[model samples]
Target chain A: MTCPEELDPVRLLTPRAREVLAAARVVLERDGWDTLTMRSLADELGIAAPSLYKHFASKDALRTQLIALALKEFGEGVRPVSGVAALVRAYRDVAAAHPQLYRLATSGSLDRDALPPGLEDWSGSPFLEATGDPHRAQALWAAAHGMVILELDGRFPTGSAPEATWDELVTHFG
Target chain B: MTCPEELDPVRLLTPRAREVLAAARVVLERDGWDTLTMRSLADELGIAAPSLYKHFASKDALRTQLIALALKEFGEGVRPVSGVAALVRAYRDVAAAHPQLYRLATSGSLDRDALPPGLEDWSGSPFLEATGDPHRAQALWAAAHGMVILELDGRFPTGSAPEATWDELVTHFG
Candidate 1:
């Protein structure tokens, strides 16, 4: 079997692909991840199950693209910030606004090796550069994610102001 | 309606209640979260649907206990460690072994208010105590969680060693 760099499936996306994805979002937001099956998505699109296969390979492939879409949206959602505190808050805001999407986006494997054209820059790159060290950026990113995940999971203590805690994390890292 | 402190549902768990939870785990592990319903769990336990109501009030309640059980198991999974590096490894190991269970446990609302009786001591409590500040504890916790989560989600750069990165986080915080 030949490596089909020329035959990349995503490059062949049609208008119908976008339609399938939009229907997926509706199902995801309404019924959630578990119920968002290929059959369910096909039903939403008013298409046969086999028709979805022509656009997307499988449910897993569709889910991966959905996560990528969410990540791209998250990158666009936050205004780029030079300061650590502002960046942290922006990250938190995105997670807070779309917790389910955030979870889905966070749980999936990102295609880092070969992202599509114009899709390589991660949402955290600017904030990461501002930290001056890639490793420090990773730590800061983890810290913010930890706080938000804990908060979303209701594992943080009552009266724990995550915003204030975020500010403190920024200082702690610096 | 009076809030009966004596009528706490979890506190009132019996041996049979433990059986119900054990059966729920079987269903959860086998069928995934969507299929781990009251009816499904009942089928696993060889009981009628309404009988589960005696031990657990709702599916949400069952889910909470399942998470608590996961946390308790996680606490027991790791050997006690006072150093940050060891603690981080332990947390990662648990997640790696049971990714789905970890996701469920992390997503649910943990009882941070009082913690179930003996749960004040988490696997990382000693490491947190080593930091000597609750806020620092939170930061370190977040850092470890963030790294593990990113690693799990395949967000880390290809060929990146998360173990080394974890060590760097320990040094960064310390």
Candidate 2:
């Protein structure tokens, strides 16, 4: 995932900090959010845990950066689709492509204060642009998110393809 | 919630184990699954952690019980609704009521091997009953789940009521 210069929030960080962010993403995708720790990330980076503190003050701080990366990548993936059905498909594909990052970015309380301004809105503009209504877009986005996350979590019945469900969701809004 | 005699899986447990299960529910809802430990359950029960193991062999074993309990309660809550709109509403209400348990039960790779046979099907029957098609029912369930989880996690924009989103989903499926 090439972070386009304009949309890249990590550019503000020092070059070494950016490397840490890259490594963190690898760790986050390889290991889940719960198991990813400063110690784990340090081991991933071939550095001591104390040195990680210099790059990222804490795990929470490091996580904030990782979320930004996920947002950017997810946003880029989902932004280009033209219609409701296509948008849902793109959303699901992007999420499926990076299930771990998708879960991390979507689940739990988001710390908006720590994120760069408009980054959230810009990341989400594709939904509004597709649906042409904020509420509808949000509903569609929520529905799409729900399908992807449930599929990722294995909540749907075992041995059943979720295509019909996905189609049902798209048929509803499309 | 009163678990119906036939529906209650916990009925298989000994009396003391039932008490421990009840206490475990309280701690799970209060502290969340990650923070929940055998030691914590023991403390909640006023017994030593080692003694708690007498009731359940491992945390995974205990969690399966908790999952059973969640399936029963969620099934009970959602089973009676007659239509897609009402089913979605009831699902959202029940999930909102027990946010922690909803997350615990719904997220992750389910251990079907551990859960009682037919418990999964019985719990999910409401969706099929309401929709009258397995695929459509699964689709509606996934859409509703998407809305509930996003709302629970504060994924929707701050201060948004999400009513329109809910209405949109129901309108699609209904």
Candidate 3:
């Protein structure tokens, strides 16, 4: 089996790409986007920074790839559920499960203009489709993003359950 | 009409406090929270940093004072609106009007637990009252915060009419 670093670019091989993405996730989780430099990633893999250009062209390229990976993971996590309520729960669960990646993905740090080809179109499609209204979809994304950031910051009501708050949001929209 | 630096501690008037707050706002807007040091503020005002200590004991004290001023401005901006639709519009306007202050106020840069007496309690009251549900209120704040941040970041849909998005959100909740 070819390692992720040596895999062919054109074909889909889940395990290899998954390994690279997992390493990227570790970089995002431990050091955050600010410190997730190419050098750092290369160091993590015991390779030189320039060698990373083989997998990803630039820092932004690496970030965009990681964001794409995150969105794919996000889509997968929310795939088992359907409808508004289940969708809301799945969205919240994905955010909670990968708080760091969620923050980095939604932090407005990635340039929409520079979003990798085909990735931007699919990033928020799940949530948007679930809401059934573009405006509501935008608002729901903002609300969920806000909830996760506030939750991570420890700004939400102390002792107030996350699931309960999520239920109220769903009810309000419903 | 004494300058802020000349105001006596016990006898300082509202206008004097406003002047100091304005200086603080300038610091926040230009340098952001990280570089908003007393010396930098004093340099902006052409006064000694020690003089600032008379008005605000520390950076935390100055930040809390600024948060109070920001909340006051925010409250005043949204006070006249009635019903949920009006409230959402008013909230959006406040955010758009002072994007920097809005970011600072909601950035979790301040110490919530050490908030000055009566400051935090009164600051978010208007928002809480508008939503009428503690959970909803919390969600609303998060949503509003995220909306402004994303809007400023230019992540929201730009082409066509986006105000319709707000209208849809309001309709959904109502």
Candidate 4:
């Protein structure tokens, strides 16, 4: 899928840096954010930790790149903006497909200063497009996020998806 | 406030164990769950880590106790259940009051088997009491959770509370 230029924060990275980031994503999926150390990432890439640091200064910088990637992919996965149900469905599908990325990008306070300017807003613009009102969009987005997160964490009681819960959310917003 | 018997998971713990859990809460708030260790709790209590282990076998068990306490307090905080607006208000207030504990309790997969039987359900029963339908209740709970978590993490654009978004959530459910 073609990512919008605004959403593609990694576009500024050199080809080798992009490769390091790709490896980082793999490591993040496997080891999670907490365990994704520079050494571990270097080990994954078969490079010395010092060499890896040349590509990305610290794990935090690497994490910022990953969050940008997550935003780009998640934004793409949920757009072009459509009806509330479709948006919610797309949101859940993208997050469910990339649960690790979803949690890493969203679970903590975002380093807005580090992230590319307007990239967060551009990615989240689809929510605005769907609802036409900021508050409603936020509510819808949060509801979808809550459902996706709870579902991913298996916080829901059943083994199966909570289809009815999702439907109720959509019905209210629709 | 009087806690319902089923909701009080810490009730069965020995006096000493309860004191250990109390110390853990202080440490958890001061340092997040990731930083909260047996050593830290023991340090807070002026004891050694071994003493902490005797009270709670591992950090995970201690975490379970914290989750139980969070759920009990959160349950009481949101009740006695009232209208959707009131419930949403109460929910946000309670979570905001204990952001650290709220994140610890709800962020990951719950160890239902390890928890006191029926405590989770009893704590969550307020949602059902408000909505009168399981799916709707789940949706509302998820929405409230989503809003609260995002707010706690300062995910919203403004530092001020997203009152409009929260009202939108309540409007739909109410």
**Which candidate's TM-score is highest?**
4
Worst 10 residues of 3 chain A by lDDT: A1-10
- Native-contact fraction for each model? 0.64, 0.84, 0.66, 0.83
Return the DockQ of model 2: 0.73
lDDT tens digits by residue: candidate 2, B133-153: 987888887777777777777
Q: Pick the candidate with the highest lDDT.
A: 4
Which structure among the candidates has the greatest DockQ? 4
**All candidates: DockQ:** 0.45, 0.73, 0.50, 0.84
**In terms of DockQ, which candidate is stronger, 1 or 2?**
2
| DockQ score for model 4 | 0.84
- Name the regions of candidate 4 deviating beyond 4 angstroms: none
lDDT of 3 by residue, B1-174 (tens): 121222222233366556776888987887777678888888888888888777666877777666656765676677765677777888888877786787777655456554444455455565677778777777676676667777865766572227776676676555
Model 2 / residue A34 / CA error / Å: 2.8
Tens digits of lDDT, candidate 4, B1-174: 457775588778999999988888888888998888777778899998887777887888888889989988888888886778888888888887888999999988778887778778878888998899999999999999888888888888885447788888899999
* CAPRI verdict (incorrect, acceptable, medium, high) for model 2: medium
- lDDT of candidate model 4 versus the reference: 0.85
Residues A136-166 of candidate 2 have per-residue lDDT tens digits of: 8888888777778778887777543467777
Q: Give the candidate order by descending lDDT.
A: 4, 2, 1, 3
Better of 2 and 4 by lDDT: 4
How high is the lDDT of residue B114 in model 4?
79
- Per residue, candidate 1 scores C-alpha lDDT tens digits across B58-160 of 8878887877677666666654656666767777787778766766677645655333654534544654566776667777776767777677556666434
Error of 3 at B9 (Å): 14
